[model samples]
Target: MKRIFILGAIFTLALNWSCGNKKTTEPPVVKPPVVSKPPEAFAGFLTVLTNDASRKIEIYDPTIENWNAAEAKKWSWAPTTALGFVTADINTFGGGTDFKLRKVPVWNNAEYAALTDNGFAAIIEYPSGKRKWSKRLSGNLHSAELLPNGNIAIAASDGGWVRLYASSQGPDQEYYAEYPLISAHAVLWDPKTNVLWVTGQHAITKAHIITALAVGGTDAVPELTEIDSWRTTIPSAWGHEVSAYYGNDNLLWVTSNGGEYVYNKTTKTFSPAPTAGLTFVKGIANQPSGQIVLTRPDYNKNPRPAMNCGLNDWSTSTVDFYSANGQLDGSRVVNGACFYKVKLLNSSYQ
Candidate 1:
């Protein structure tokens, strides 16, 4: 007919150009699926353990309140030379600021460790934060604890030393079994019973570790055995400085300057927290949000200080944050900043 209609219109234009150049494997480029950024439950950096402040162990940021010093540089202390403060996830360090508060300087890490009232101890060695070991004991060595097995427990508020190191100690060493408490000053570590609760100056000891520490050579010298001990009914003249906590029913709160009480270790009884009116206490903690935190001694509060837990006027208070039924939610007025104790370290990983 017209060359068979021009060969059927060139076979329908070569069958529509071979189905548009036939590369039909086009359903395999589906990529809008990459969403990993969610690990921060709690831990926003708050471990400013000072005691006789020259800035001993600091890394603060209670959500920052514009405490002006260039905004306190995101949260002070990328510096060290401590003589106090420890506790909060085995003594917290690292991750204080991407905001110029910088990071990594917990003595340069090795799962880093810290203690300094001049008697030193900075164990380390995790994903290689390196110092893997060190100890100098004898100076004021105020506090430390990390022994659910990976040994290292010191407390030397001036030679009442209750030492025990064996995470393979050997760098600047001096800890390999040393516990016979005569007067410790707070060194608590009882994750329910890997025991060790020293606090003497009237007495309170309950150690336990008859040999258990060694995961890499040089394994010996780990023996602390003081099943249980207690004596502080306080008022031994009030120059007291205490700290004790393992609460929630079996209770056992103990803090002093004679205030902060509650000890019912199954009724060996002495209770008083119907809402303590804070006058002076030195350090007691417990808060996975159930709150009950203390650290008192408010910078001569006649006027030039701050912290007023609603001031029923207990002399102006230093650090209180109650509410395990005892009300009072917040307060922090460290005017003489030697704030000696705090470790709210579940910082949501900042």
Candidate 2:
């Protein structure tokens, strides 16, 4: 009986050892969850001029998403040696030699054909390889804007006229009218009210004139009524150098060779904004956050002078951000030849 009890005790010990070994063994390997990188932030598109041998129109997308350096995409039609402005549509339009107006077809997407010095009123399609329409103007077009109603608003410098052209029946129908001022250069259309705003130098003097066009008229006659007129408070200075109207604020911002001013349509008063850091401010764009972005001409110096520079040069270009309280929040130096215009792609993007 004693011998049998010993054997049974040994068997019980062996079973306990096997159970312990099984519990100590490793379990199946488990994997970790996959992590995804964040999506890149999209910086607003910028119009830059190429400094290389081509001197072409380059569109810079400052990949704000990934915080990467700006990537430049060039256009086939070069605006070299020309005074021009780049519209937000990635179209570079400017006055060529001898008032020959031209536009780059569209940046990126090679399917579209390029436009090189097409006539004064050539309408190049965005991202499409086709010229929608073109019309001959009475004089050299200094500036042009595409209206929301699919028409083109143009300001002539020599003739001092503002005209509107509508595409109808496969041809551009032109409606032209004379304004009070000759040498009108800048023009814009207010999408909210379909009002056309025209700016130019008074034919007889250095003073500037602003006119509002009568909309929905088959006749090209823009009502010559002056919305606002001003002479440079400073001697021998020009007023109404550049004008932009903000639809959100209903304010008209104008900058001249002398200074910058904002007109409150509600109050019918004009107030001056800070132009100390601005030299030859060419474009005024309003952002979604009630801020303004100003673009200016290029500087000529290396280690480009900061925004505080009093002179206008190729190296002096900057983007100034202004809040609703009329205070400058910050500024970034811009490297581009002849920074003629700055536009906000979307208010929300800012």
Candidate 3:
């Protein structure tokens, strides 16, 4: 009886201890849900200016899901009476298809400067396709730049002239002040320095804008005072185009038949660009993303050589993009298209 009682007591104690040590029934941990971020958006596009009979100015988006030159065009334009402006004369401007679309600056790419091998320079409004100011002048008109004072400067290669017009006089305004620049092919207005840089066949010239003279009145005559000029960096080279280096305010991009170069504004010296030694580069565009867009006549495919700085035949169907280090990154080609120049469709101009 004593053993039984002892055994019973021990079993009861063990049972009690086991019951006490039992882990309290606990619920499992529940973690909060995770949230993910949305994908980033692309922020770049390019403007392709063609010199074909189509005379197309197309906006190309490189960020398309499956990029196709045919489908990549976001918008396009060809001069027509529907644009509310007199169409370029076919006889004078080459088959009414030679509106060489140049700088599309101002109002967030809302305005464009166009010219013909003949005497035609005009600023056309984008989307609406209306003329803000235009003029027919003598000389082989090549490029145009809008001045901060609401005037326009046009470069003519044939007559070696950079003509300034008072845009306030309206589209048909004929009066202009001329500055001689031998074989001038391109003009760019520097808003920061308030000067005009003209690229010609043999030299790059810088001119000071006489604000007092550019009052834009009927009697006011604008003047471009020659501050200085530098000879072509490449020996016997023909300067073709001049554009603001959007990545560097101290530099400007200049292309020539000899090669592509970067002109330092502070030093007034031309240096070989990353794409130096490349010949026949007609147009250049520096992008904020460190890429370089350039156009060169594909003579192999086009089978037409340039005729005395005239680009009527200097074009190809392909526009090339280079990496920041100057490697050929990619190319966009539109079959049967003659791409002469390309500009970045952004508001950035360093």
Candidate 4:
């Protein structure tokens, strides 16, 4: 009986010790949720300008989505309507503020000249922002191109002529040449062929001349002699607006009023582009990423003719991005009417 009582006491003591010293398990740890940021509206910088008299050279950085007005380094001093960037100061010719319709540039390469719709024309220097020379042509300045041999070919709408600034003396030396036409609108310098393509209110002319020419083998070189010319002559060409550019690989793209078409040089044929509702294209640019940027003025609210200069007042600027195949990639709108031309520059260029 004594042994049995001692055994029971030992068993109870062991049971109590095991129950009191039971091991406890801790809970698992958790982390808080993470947040992400959205992408930018655009990848690089863009220059936006207006057609009206009250206009500013607005610079927009689409990456951060902000307008950078203070960073603008202009090549010309007058109220600018067209832009051309060069490495040297440009020359200018004085004229009154007699304004008219502005011409859209074919490419935004480093240009040696800038034209103001107020009849002011000037050559600008890049890296220095100096005015080397300027000349007030006979009519309202639409567009101008700096030749390879240090000459300038200007398209003046008032006189319906393309003027050639011939210079054998140097960059500063210049003489003027006038070629009659219905209306000279766009002057483009294609680096690939070293040919200047000039578009007018009704026709597109192919100008060929690497060196300035003499009038009779003794006079100054005309620089640009018309080699070939063709007319789009579409229904829209009746004067609303017309813009053209060598899109890529021997294909020429033309848009007027609101109609767009592609002319294939290989087959010498034309086909309608997929430009459905995009009316009144202001400019066209081919980006390095194989995307084409087009400036579309809001035609619904934009009027064809306004007071004063009687130039069309473009509504809010609408820019569209399209693939090489004419597929609409995306689009965005900017506030303000009288929007003129839109240009894209690599962020690195800034």
lDDT of 2 by residue, 226-325 (tens): 4444232221123333444444446676654433566554554556653332323445655444555665433312234444233223112354455555
Candidate 4 TM-score, C-alpha based:
0.59
Tell me, by lDDT, which candidate is best: 3
Q: lDDT of model 2 at residue 264? A: 56
Identify the runs in model 4 with alpha carbons over 4 angstroms from their true place.
1-40, 44-59, 68-118, 167-174, 201-220, 229-247, 274-277, 299-312, 315-318, 323-337, 345-350
What TM-score quantifies how close candidate 3 is to the native fold?
Answer: 0.72
**Runs with alpha carbons beyond 4 Å of true place in candidate 2:** 1-58, 62-119, 135-140, 168-175, 191-193, 203-206, 219-237, 240-247, 274-277, 299-336, 346-350
Error of 4 at 103 (Å): 21
TM-score leader = 3
lDDT of 3 by residue, 29-112 (tens): 212112122212234555545445445556677555323435777776645566655655322443111233333433454455
- Relative to the true structure, candidate 4 has a C-alpha RMSD (angstroms) of 27.6
lDDT of 4 by residue, 142-257 (tens): 55555554455566555666776654334355566666655455555544445555545433332211111122121255644654433334323312222233236565554443
* lDDT (0 to 1) per candidate: 0.39, 0.40, 0.53, 0.40
Tell me the TM-score of model 2: 0.57
Each candidate structure's TM-score, on Cα atoms with residue i matched to residue i, is 0.28, 0.57, 0.72, 0.59
Instruction: For candidate 1, write residues 85-159 as lDDT tens digits.
Output: 234312333221011011123333124443333345554432232444444445355556554344566666446
lDDT at 71, model 3: 70
